[model samples]
Target: MQLVVARIGRAHGIKGEVTVEVRTDEPELRLGPGAVLATDPASTGPLTIATGRVHSGKLLLRFEGCLDRTAAEALRNTLLIADVDPEDLPEESDEYYDHQLMDLDVVLADGTEIGRITEISHLASQDLFIVERPDGTELMIPFVEQIVTEIDLEEQRAVINPPPGLIDDSQAEVASERDDA
Candidate 1:
């Protein structure tokens, strides 16, 4: 599958180069000459890299055929993707990709299956796990070491001890009060 690594922001200069907001953790390894990138959900063409360099912490990219400001401007907001082999990804014992965590079963410390992970959000302070219950209710659980005790990626399960006043019943009551108001 192709994973998105960057998005074309704007035309950097008149010479076919565009500024990119990098999404990958290893930007240096991903951007280089002769690299192939696919623009997702918009242009269907596979963009072949003519040149790439980091300028002021952002990636500057020039496509093989794209020349001049007009051609480069046309690619604004295009997501750059590279074909990724799942096996090629590094295995961190505790850390996991957001995509891998999504839709995994979320169980409590005592072995009660409460929900499935629907999304993983990165906040200013920490990561948040959005778990969705069978009844369609969503719980925003903070991904803290104390709360999220264990993550078994091989088993596709996360063991969590939810903080006080964050359970399904308490959250539902809070939602109900908001609705009533």
Candidate 2:
């Protein structure tokens, strides 16, 4: 089983229990005992859940090996993950993980292939996609239903209807100006 859940933030307490910034919608259910958290391929170690409780509406977790303030502090920026069952995910057809969107080809409404998605950034109001074109130009597109019309994950392509002045030929000139500045 592959672990997909990301540890967004840390816990706040004195008992070696850290708050987990859950990536999944169901945080309460997934932070149960015996859940394994793999940090990386080289650091893929199990985090035995000593106890889990909700404090101030956040998931507070205590691992078996971590039993002190220093131990919990060590995990301040660490990520927690567990094996996810694909069937357990939400049935929303439009929803996709950021990892799944990476490397997807971005195309305009007129079938002009713009770029490939390199990253997804979060803004105060919406998510933005960083796309890298073949010409090495990077375009920042707002990821909204209004602009993104279709996402074919199997084909690894995203069809977008960019807003006016977003992808015009003059946009390159603006980019060059910014680079010069």
Candidate 3:
């Protein structure tokens, strides 16, 4: 499988270094120097990483054959893709990649069908699973331990333990009385 690991940002200085917005969790392994990555535009790459550094908390990478600002600027907004094997799983048992979680059937604890995970939206606070329901409507489910209880990769399913009102407003309770006497 091909995973987008980073997006090339603006050129960093006169050198061929370009700032990048990292998309992968394992940057050191994927973005390390001498790592050859495929590019999105196809014609721009496959580019080879000559060097990488962290400057001002941002990752900067210099590609081989790109020796100046102009050359680096040409790669701006280009996506860097990394080749990955389907069987190559994460070392941690509990951890999973976004690609691994995608397309899994979402179900309730008793195996009630909810939806299918279409996208994983990474937010500043928490990740959200964009689920497509059987009725063709989309539902945003919080990807938290309190809600998403289990992930059965072998079965290709995700079991969620949703609280009342989480699945539908009909299951939610509303106030029946007010104290504004």
Against the reference, the lDDT scores of all candidates come to: 0.82, 0.75, 0.92
Candidate rank order under lDDT: 3, 1, 2
lDDT of 1 by residue, 114-179 (tens): 899988776769889999988999988899989889988789999998755677577667777887
Better of 1 and 2 by TM-score: 1
Steric clash pairs (candidate 3): none
**RMSD (CA, Å), each prediction:** 4.7, 5.0, 2.7
Candidate 2 overall lDDT versus native: 0.75
If the candidates were sorted by their TM-score against the true structure, best first, what order would they fall in?
A: 3, 1, 2
- Over the stretch 90-157, how does candidate 2's per-residue lDDT look in tens digits? 55877876667889999987779999999887676988999998999898999999999999877889
- The candidate scoring highest on lDDT is 3
- The global Cα lDDT (0 to 1) of model 1 is 0.82
Most accurate candidate by TM-score? 3
| Candidate 1 deviant stretches above 4 angstroms | 123-125, 167-181
What is residue 158's positional error in candidate 1, in angstroms?
1.5
Candidate 3 per-residue C-alpha lDDT over 41-133 given as tens digits, one digit per residue, 9 for 90 to 100: 989999999999999999999999999999999999999999988888888998899889999999999999999999987787988999999
